[model samples]
Target: MTPITEVEGRRLALSNLQKVLYPATGFTKGEVLHYYATVADALLPHLRDRALSFLRYPDGPDGQVFFAKNVPPGTPEWVTTARVPRSDGPARMVVVQDLASLVWAANLVTEFHTPQWVVQEPEIADRLVLDLDPGAPATVVECCEVAVWLRERLAADGIEAYPKTSGSKGLHLLAAVRGASSERVTEYAKRLAVEAEEAMPGLVVHRMTRSLRPGKVFVDWSQNAARKTTAAPYTLRARAEPAVSAPVTWDEVARCRSADPLAFLAADIAPRLQDHGDLLAPVLDADRAGSVP
Candidate 1:
């Protein structure tokens, strides 16, 4: 029988604890639970009041994976949700506001993704993001270079940016911005991408056309759109190994040149939190958010 554990007054039946979720690394469901529970303090702030788009891999990362928008069937009553209108119709998405809900979702082996805005302000963006993705022949090392340029460019615009590993390839540069509509941020991000392409030429590509991607870093600026979502920081990705979308320091982003930098795994987050206490913490402060200009 699966054991039932009480977390913050919620009785969660965390099943399949011994089941491996990352076949290559033998990481189990139990480890996933532990990682979320351990990173809760640093992770929850980024997720609270934000509607989630979960990617569930019930059969492990190597097996079938499905996207979950509405709350999973049988979600507990205490779990928070936001009913937002979609192009098709109204949709209810889970808001993993606390430790209990997070663990419950992790129990289902989910990879968390959230939009740039919060539930309270759906169409307005609180953050701007640029996903610096590299095509083959170019690795995250190339992404690091582009991120540094983008960071400086953003800073000149008075927006402070933070870096994180995409947990797959490349880097993500995010900055908290004040009172801008999703369209505004999206357009601003696109302008930056285009500017970077102009500045770097062969080193960067702004458009998503597949043929133009190779040997260049594609500055994906569309994650700022109201409907688009980004992987929540500290969330595990469904990969062959248990890689995480972990935050990094500017120092790490600046000096990262093939020194095998910015790669973080599930087991690496707890210690990182202890040392840095969430490098992205400033990005969570709405009051301190800079203008999108």
Candidate 2:
């Protein structure tokens, strides 16, 4: 029988609470739900108004996995969803608005949550993301070096950016921008990547080719496209261990250059939140907005 728990007055039916989701860390399904519940206050703001794409690992990290763009059939009507028009047709995507909606998604073993960069209008974007992907032999430390350099460049342009772990191997830097067409955002990101590559010839590469990645970080500005989605901050990754896509301080990034690559994990997020109180909060602020062009 499925055990039901009431979260802030909303009855949430949970299943497989004892099922192990991360064998390396012995993290269970219940713990995943609990993490979301605990961080819901901080996590929900990022998810609100964004179309969610669920990456589910029903069995565990070692088990079968699949991606679902639309909220699965039988999703409770109480949960809010947005019908966004696609080239094929309009698809309904889940919008995590409150604790109830968050836990409901976690109950489905949703390991990673990804959202569009824009709100409501799927074809527009209000944020610019630069995904720093380090190739083999080039660790996250190298990515951090490149990120700090890029951050300085963006700052010179009057853009305030925030940094966060990719929850796997890379890092993502985001900045709030005036709402613009997706093409405009993508082009702006591309130009920035090109300039970075030119400024630091061998250290940064804007191209996506793997051959050029060794000992260098790839500035993946292409993520700014309308169809592309990056992992939502504070969501758990599907690594052998339960690592989270956590927001970090610029100071932490500088320190990580000489520290562990996977320095942040699911267990580390809450305390950091208590200390820093959502470092990425400014990205959502309308008054803090900047533009790529």
Per-candidate clashes, comma-separated = 0, 0
Q: Candidate 1 — worst ten consecutive residues by lDDT sum?
A: 253-262
Off by over 4 Å in 1: none
In order of appearance, the predictions have TM-scores of 0.98, 0.95
Residues 49-145, candidate 1, lDDT per residue (tens digit)?
A: 8999999998888799999998789998999998986668889989988999999888888999989998988989998999989999989989999
Superposing all C-alpha atoms, what RMSD in Å does each candidate have to the true structure? 0.9, 1.5
How do the residues 1-293 of candidate 2 rate in per-residue lDDT, one tens digit apiece? 99988876878789999999999989999899889888888888888888888888989878988888888987989889888876578888888788888899999988545444545567768788999998878878888888898899888878888999898788999898876777898898888889989988878899998889888889998878777778888998888988888898898888885536445777888998999998899999979988666
Q: How close is candidate 1 to the true structure, as a TM-score?
A: 0.98
Error of 1 at 240 (Å): 0.7
